[model samples]
Target: YAGPLLEEEALNKAAEKGLSSPEFLELCVWLGSQIKSLCNMEESITSTDGGKDVESFQLEVSSFLREMACPYSSLISGDIKDRLREKEDCLKLLLFLSTELQALKILNSKKMKGSHLEKHNEVYQEVQTICDALGLSNSSASDILPLLTNVEQKIKDILSKVQNNHVGKSLLTKPLNSEQVERLGKINDALRSEYECRRRMLVKRLDVTVQSFGWSDRAKVKTDDIARIYQPKRYALSPKSTVTLAHLLAAREDLSKIIRTSSGSTRENTACAINKV
Candidate 1:
């Protein structure tokens, strides 16, 4: 029932064809089983059609991504691979969003239960811990982190509503209200400080992560540096004798100078003999 609603109608068409075409029966059976499994789940399954209700939506979206991951695995080539990667990215985003939302829900629930609003710092710290454990990747964190600001605003709005209700009604005398106002101011200050610190930390990590795109190039250059250029010498060394081309050139120059300096008949005869040779 939910499968047809959640999945496209073509799934049902395929199931009908499965009765006549044996080739499609396998897919039909698998899809039917998947739907049956979902139906068999206890009523605890949230009926959040596309996650409209905050709690119900989160639960439903989480379950939806897990199920979508199945057909995503069947993708073998072309754009499907990209789509699969996108789905994976979406999964991570959902995970982060759901984790944070769930945490905020818990915190708000506790606050609503009269546990004391002073413990918001502890609650924020716990949320930070959960974020770290998730080991978020660049591909997903960008898409997911933005939702945090929205959720944060929602939290602030809710908290403000709670405080407003408490402050209204003239429940406290002027002096007591003044003292409570001071405490509330301090709490807000502490929360602002924490949010600033967390934002800076996230920014620093994002900068490093962005720089990592070039890190592979840096690694390649470092590897290439290990290889020195092969320089070719003009002459080779003989056993126990290191003879460079400079030595041969110098010797030839000396011989040429000797021949040039000679000017007598003997030199002329010698030059004539050298030329003949």
Candidate 2:
């Protein structure tokens, strides 16, 4: 008997003191409306007359249950109004109706989900048909965007090359005289010297700025030397080296000593003992 239509406190109160005639009628009307909407019925079987009495409410509830093809529709009859006056009977009826309504809502949701899946399938089939008409491979659908992007990029590149060639031809149509060529060479030399001077000035300024920030190549080299001095070194075994019986006997003694020393000692102490050995 728990749902959006009924609150826990209200249901508890109804269980203690059976649902009032007006409250019962109101629930029945709400149930009828929900059933009609879920079933896609054009018209409601329950009456909406404001002056309806207890017997009319019961009859409407029975009709709604029957219309929904409820298995327990027989439980709701003309005498249901009297039975609902008792707290136990009212709770039983409420539970039954709530269960039926919840089932209907679940069924309707599943039906809507199935319809949505069908629509998605139809769209996929339409896309597949269009791809077939275009003579595209079945796998092309997955990579169509990448293929189109590649083609567009290639077209842009071809256009750029054509534009560059046209500009080159236009320039070549007008030849330079020997005097003009000599003047151009002199100007090029002057620009190159100016560029070199500016580049040197920029490098000097960068060096000064770095020194002001206390950063120097000498300091970096010193730090690297200190790190190398403190770092542990690992030696690799030579491929041509062979282990003799003495080496094996020494290893077995080291293992026995390590096991005895580590039994009750902390990891750091055990490591120190192993190092000493």
Q: Which candidate is the best by lDDT?
A: 2
Clashing pairs in 1: 51-57
* Model 1 poorest ten-residue lDDT run: 230-239
Candidate 2 lDDT over 56-90, as tens digits, reads 66666665556556565335554665745666766
Per-model CA lDDT versus the true structure: 0.43, 0.57
State the TM-score for model 2: 0.43
How well does model 1 score by local distance difference test?
0.43
How many collisions between residues are there in candidate 1? 1
lDDT of 1 by residue, 1-277 (tens): 2333235455444434422333233332333334435334332223323534433433443354444443433232244224223434333432343354455557667777665444654555545554555442223333335545555665566567675554234322234356766776666667666766776676666556544644686655654342232112211211222333223323432243444446675565667654777
* Residue 155 displacement (Å), model 2: 13
